[model samples]
Structure formats: structure tokens, C-alpha cells
Target: KTAVRVSCGEEHTAVLTKGGAVFTFGSGRYGQLGHNSSQDELRPRLVAELWGAKVTEIACGRFHTLVRTDSMKVYSFGRNDQQQLGRGEDSPPSVPLPVPLQQLCATSGLVIENIFAGGDSSFATCVHKKDLCRRLKNDETPPSVENMVDTWISGCDSKLLKKIKKEIHETFSSASCMNRSFLSQSKDKHFQTSPDYPGLDFSLAQSVFKKLLKKEVLSTEVQAAVVQLLPALDGNPVGVEGLRVFLVLNELLHVIQKLKKQPNTRLAEEVAAAVQKLSPENLQIIDSKVTDVYKRDFFHHLFLRIVSDKPEMFMFNDSETLVWFSSEASEENVVNFYLFGVLCGLALYNNSIVHMSFPLVLFKKLLDVEPTLEDMIEFSEAVGGSLKYILDYEDDDLEDQDFTFKIHWDGMDVDLDPQDPQKAVTSQNKKQFIDAYVNYAFNTSVEKVFQEFQRGFFQVCDQRLLKLFHPHELQGMLVGEAVYDWEVLRQ
Candidate 1:
């Protein structure tokens, strides 16, 4: 509940937590407090609407507030007569709502990097994109935030949408270039031939599609326009058109996966049907390269959400599809890059122990596929050893909620001299990199997070399996004294 930072509006104040939670207090008139009410709060109160979100920063205008989440989403609530909220709505918002930076983000693929407010107007900024710099040139007017929503909703930019649709159509209509586009690197303009799948901008389509979705500009007309074109690529598994269709569907699945609510079943079915249309040969290609398709700016958001404890962000419920994917990936051969991503996520999100249900057999196979030593030891400690020692056969009713672990990181020993010209990567630099990596994985307390994952593992696994971990091994894991090989831990 500690506030890492606090901001004050004209009369209201908002606080952001070390844990990324948001709380607000003071006046709420004009909805500046972001709690969806105009009444003043005498003390700090949680903004329930943003419960699952991790807010990183907050900015307040004279009579409004703008908060940015770690996920790059910005929300505003308060006075907006000047349209400072950046929303399309005519009236002020009483609750925190997402601000549409869709147009700006579509061009830059950057988050709201900074925000500033004036007496009557609000300004937000995104990371400058090199491509935008090249495209805008020296003569264009400076960008303005006015009328964004109006322009978006009224389709004032319908030509752009049509252009995108046409590009999709033409790309997929050709039979020669389908699979190549999906795996092609971004192309230099001078060397590029086809504009649709221009030199390695595969992620451009992904970002554009996501930007369109975020803007609330996606229309039924647009969806139908894209989906209706799919039939033309039938039987031509490697056709250029089929690749285009898959790209759109893949981005849609990513978007739908991030929704906190029940998915749009109709859209899901449409996407599923499209996936089903891929012949077995084509399906193998997709299965092999699925991870590559997901490596855009949206990957972090999608990975963080899907690997969450409750894990409902994505539905891979098609058993037949799962079988296909699994067949292409194994200990001797790995097809999907996401399999390792999932394992890394499991290690990071503390789901490492759940793999114990397969009796460590599946976990062993994964280790062979990618012998990332650090990940394996972290996973082993998380799933196997640490929890049994801590819990020690407690009854179901025995709650040890008060137990906590205090962790500390010792600095590394580096003897290399930085002044030596021959030593580009000094020992100190290597140590720094290693420490930084470990800190990122474990956050502040490496020991505490490691123990917590172990606790979670114990909470999930059967009591009988506690015997699988030897006492000495459990002690070694808990004290951070173990050296586990990626090859040996699974055994």
C-alpha cells in the first residue's frame, strides 16, 4: 500500500503504489480523482475499476487526472470540456477510461511515454518513431490531439482503412508469395517490390491491426471485408492470400486474448474456422512459426496476461490443434518458439510447480529442448524442493499467512581492469549484466519470490509428492546453495 509517487490536481490527489496499484483521495469534483464519483474523499481509496491493472505513473491536470499503466494503456477521468481526456465522448468521464492514442501509436508503436497538462488542454507524447520522421518530412504541421475520436468514429480516415483492406486483399490474392511474406524480414524501400508485405514490416501489419482495435475503429464492415476474402485462398495452402488471412486472424486472436471479459465468441469462431481451413501441410508451417508471428510490440502484454495464475487470457481448447502443435515440438525437436516462452513465463509467473502433475517428465523434456540453466534451476526450486520444507505437512486448516522471507543479493566478484584496452568486456561488466538479469527475474527479493513460488507449488501439488524432494536438496534450494544442471534436474 506504500505510495511510490503521488500527484495532486487542483483539489484532488492520486497515488501510485510500489506494487503498481492506484489510490486517490481529496476532492473528486469534476471526477478528477478517477473513482467514478464527484464527491470528495477524506482519505485515500482504491480505484477498483483498475484493480487488475498495474499503473506505473500518474499525471494530473488542473481539474483532471491521467494515469498510465505498465501495459502502456492510459486512462483519464475528470474535466474534459476542452477534450483533454482524449476520449471521443462528448461529456466528462466519472471513471478511469482508456484514452485512444490509436492513431499516434499506430504510426510509432510507442506507449504514452510522457504527459503534460495546461490550464485547459492536455498533451501526451509517444516515443518518436524513425519511420514517422521519414514519412512526415520537414513541411508537415505539428500533430494535434483534437477531434481524434470524431475522426476515428466518423471514418473521416475511411480511405486509409480502405487502403489497408485493399492491401490485405491484394497480398493474399496472389498465390506465389503467401508463406514467404509471413517469414520475410522487413525490407529496405529501395529493394522492396511488393508494397503489401514491404521489406520486413511483418510487425507493421500486427501493430496497425492492434492500433485499429484500440481506437475502437474496428467496424463490422471491416471485419467482414477481411473475413469474406478468405475463401479465395482455399486449397492453396502456401498461397500469398492465405498468409495474409492468417496474419489478420493471428493478430485478432492476440487482441481477443487480452480481454478480461468473456471473448467475442462469434469472432473467435470466425478465427477458428479460418485456422481450420489451413491444410495439414499449411498447419505444420503455422505450428512451427507461431511464435515468430507473436514477436511484435504486443508480445510482452500477451505473454504476461496469458501466463497469469488463473490463465484465462487465451483459449487453446481445440484438442486437435493442440495435438498438432505438440507433435511438432518435442525433446529432440522443437518447432514452436512459444514453448520456451511459456516455460520462461512459468518460471517468471511462479507456475513452475504445476508441471509436477506430469511427474517432471514433461519438464525434463523441455529442459532438453532448451538448456537454459538459470531457468531450469529456478523452475526446479519453484516446483520441487523449496515448498515441502517450508510447509512441512501442515493441515489444511493450518494457515501460515504471516510467514515471510527476507532476501538479499550479494555483489559479484570481478577482478578485471576496465582501463585495459584489450578487455572490452571486463569482468565487472559481465557481473553487472548477470546481476541485472537476476534482479529482473526475481524483482527486489530473489529469495522471497523464489520461496513464494515454492509456496504456490506446494499449494497446488499433492501432499504425497512432498517425499520426492530430499531434505538436503530442499535445504540447498532454500538457502540458494544449489547448482543444478539443466540436464540433471529433471531426472
Candidate 2:
């Protein structure tokens, strides 16, 4: 909020704040504001495009701007008709882009100490590193495990160790900092982060974590820093670049396991809690665009009515609190089942919510894990209770239970054996009868709709990351564990 310096163009203004944040206001006709737009700003607005840099100085031309960062890199934007930006004519016209100086620095071994821009001229003064209070930062790659370990072991009492520790805290506690880290900087490929290629170096994260674990001090610091990262995480991070942190965390968990350390189930569960709180509340709300409001309201309205709207597709317990696919499904509305799966997918990918928690059997089915009679017990107490009761009965008492291959479910009768509809259930065949019943409930009766639902659910987060979780873990991540102690829940 405190301005360190201010520069004025013909009609624009640039303010350099104390913490090295830049803000702009007034005319943006030629992008002199450097806020990535030509729209005029009535109030000073922060230029968020430059996230990681420590901007030391700012200058404004008649219709352009330039900034120098501690990283010894100069970025320029706005009118470049005279090539004043130190970039080619094809460079971006409005957005602040780095002025290509890597070759100049590499060959001349020069450190850019200062930068200035006005009219059609700009300058970068080269100087010795001794002239500055500290060594000038170069294009900062993230801390390598090898370097961090060496520093931790060798610089225990030195200022360099202090600097590394500061960097560690900043990188772990800030989402943007973590997102911009672990890049594959070759050919500047780090700038190209998309769904197909997230541009994260997972191998780098693994190597760093592995090395850090070797030193007790460094290992403790790494765990502390990562734990510090949780409170700052905003679920459904913005852009593919933001997703890199999550991938890095995933890799970190794997490395911890390979090191034979206990996987942090509590950490994972805490993260899952944060994940479930992902809300569309942060999205821009435009009145004219129905979709802008659809995602927010959809969870509030649609999910509130899902069970009531399609009672035939799902069977519920006596209280209607528990739900699963009906054995007697309606073929006419099979597509609705798929759409329901899509809603579940949206919950995973888009921060939508379902009103009720599904049984663990649902997650098992989604992960292609086989369901058993015990799982059925959680799904349907009456059916599962009866099957277990029959199985527990003595050979003489089994006949008194009227055991048969035929049973009634969801208002429809289903035969365990299609070949023998009236087959008897005896002690010799009790296991066979229970297995058939479990198969019919989880597989035979609902396979088609479940497949479609799975397709729809995976459509959003349908990536392979689903395999990292066990069925119970996936259930926790999706539905979350119920809180019995409300007063003890973390805020």
C-alpha cells in the first residue's frame, strides 16, 4: 500500500510499492499501465501477471512501460514501434513480456543493474556484483534437492543457509510460488502448461524429497514446509500451471512411501477436506451468461432434488438416507443415470457438491475393485442381514428360513440362477448363493448404468490419478468422513 516510487507517462501512471508490487492507473491506450489491457483504470490496480518477480524499479514511456527485477531480467510492454522494448517487432503489444537478454548476459557475463524507459529509448546498465548489497539473482530455477542437501549440511551456520530457508518457506506457503516452481526451463517450455502437459518435473520433486529425507534437519524442514502448504491451498487451482503443485505433492507422497516412511494419512485427509470445499463461488458471475450462475446454483437445487426426481433409478433404505442403484432400473431413463455420474464427475473436477454421501461400495465399483458380502451389508442391511443370517444358521435351521434362489428387491423379483429359477439354498451351496446375490446387486443388475455413470464421472477428472487411492481413501476424498464432534473440527 505504500508507494516506493511513481512514474508518469503522457496519460498513464505507474506506482512501485514497497514490497516490489507494481500498480497502474489512468490511460492504458497503448498498454502503458502494463496491466495486460488497454482499458483505463479509475483506481490503481495491481499487475498480477508478474507473480514471482521482485520488481525493483518501474518506468513509463509516452505509451509504453519497462520494469527491472532483482532476477537481473528486464520486462517491457506497450508500444514497441521503434523496438524500444529490446524485443523484435513481433513481440506482444500490450502484455508485459520479458525482454530477451539471455544471450547478452551469457556472452558478456553482464549483470543488469538498472533499467529506464522514456520516449522511444530504453537502457540496461551493466555493473559488477560487488557494487550491490547482495549478489544479484539470476533467472531463478527452483531449489534442487542436491543443492538444498549440500547447503543444509555445509552451511549450517552461514547466511546462505538462512537465505535458502527463507526461500523454502516462501515457496511452500505461497500457491503462486509453488506453481511457478519445478519447471522444465529448457527452451522456456515451462511457459507452456496445459492439460496435456502440465510442465511439472515430478522426477525433480521426487529426487529433491528423497535427498532431503537423508538429513534429519532438512527432512524436518521439508515436512514442516509441506505441512505449511496445506492451509494456503485453494482447491481447483487456476490454470494448468496451478495444477503442478498438486502433482508435485502426489509425487512427494510416493517418494515418502518408497523411503519406507509412513504415508501421512492425516495430511491426505486434511487435503481431502480442503478439496471438498472447492466452490464455484470464486468464478466471475455474469448476469447475461446463464452458465456463469449454473454451476453455483446447480449443486444447491439439482442435488437437493436428485433422489426425489428419480426414485426409480435408485433404491433407498427405510429412512431414504442411504441410496444405491435400483435392481429394478428403468431402461427409459438410463441416460439420467449417466448424467448423474457426470454430476459426480463435476464434484471431483469442478467443485460441485452432492447432498448425501454414497456408500464405499460405489467407490469400489468405480475403481474396478470387487465388492463383497460385507460391502453389501453397508449398502442394504435387510438383504445383507438376511444373507448373513442364512449363512450363520445351522444345517437344520437353514430350511426354516425358507432359503431359495429367488428373491424380491426394489419391488421386483430376481432369480439368482437364470437356469434354475427355483433352485434350493442348502448348507453345501450357501457360499454360492451369497456370492450370486452379491454379484447380482453390484454387477449383473446395474452394470450398464454404472458403466455409463463411470464414463461420465471420469469425464472431468477421468485421468489416471484416480488409481493413487484405495477405495476407502477415495470414499473419504469424495464423500468425506462424518464429523461426530462438531466443536473439535478445524476451521
> When superposed on Cα atoms, how far off is each prediction in RMSD?
25.0, 16.9
Q: Candidate 1 lDDT, tens digit per residue, 1-491?
A: 55678887778888888788888888887988777789999999898988999988888888888888877788888888888888976654878888877556866565456676676677877765664456558657622212332344456356777654454444434433333443433333313323243223445445544544554334344455445654555644434334544654565556655632554445545444454445444544443344443333223333333233222212221221110012112332221223323333333223222211111212322222222334323434442233333334344432233222221222223222334423332222433433333343333322332233334333333434535655433333222233459788677
The regions of model 2 sitting more than 4 angstroms off are 1-145, 154-168, 274-378, 383-491
Residue 22 lDDT in candidate 2: 90
- Candidate 2 lDDT over 1-491, as tens digits, reads 65778998888888897789999899888777777778999999988887779899998888888988878778888888888888878766778889877558657656777778868888877765555435435546656545755666676556676676776676666666665557776655665666566676666766777876666556556667877887677666656465566566655555665674565554444443433333332111111112322344344344545665567778776566677787666776577676667567665554544666678889888888898998878877888998898778776656556788997766779988989998888888898999988888888888888887787677656548888889987776666675456778654
Q: Give the TM-score of candidate 1.
A: 0.26
Evaluate residue 11 in candidate 1 and report its C-alpha lDDT on the 0 to 100 scale.
86
> In candidate 1, which residue ranges exceed 4 Å CA deviation?
128-491
lDDT of each: 0.49, 0.70
Worst 10 residues of 2 by lDDT: 281-290
In model 1, the number of clashes is 8
Clashes of 2: 0
- The lDDT of model 1 is 0.49
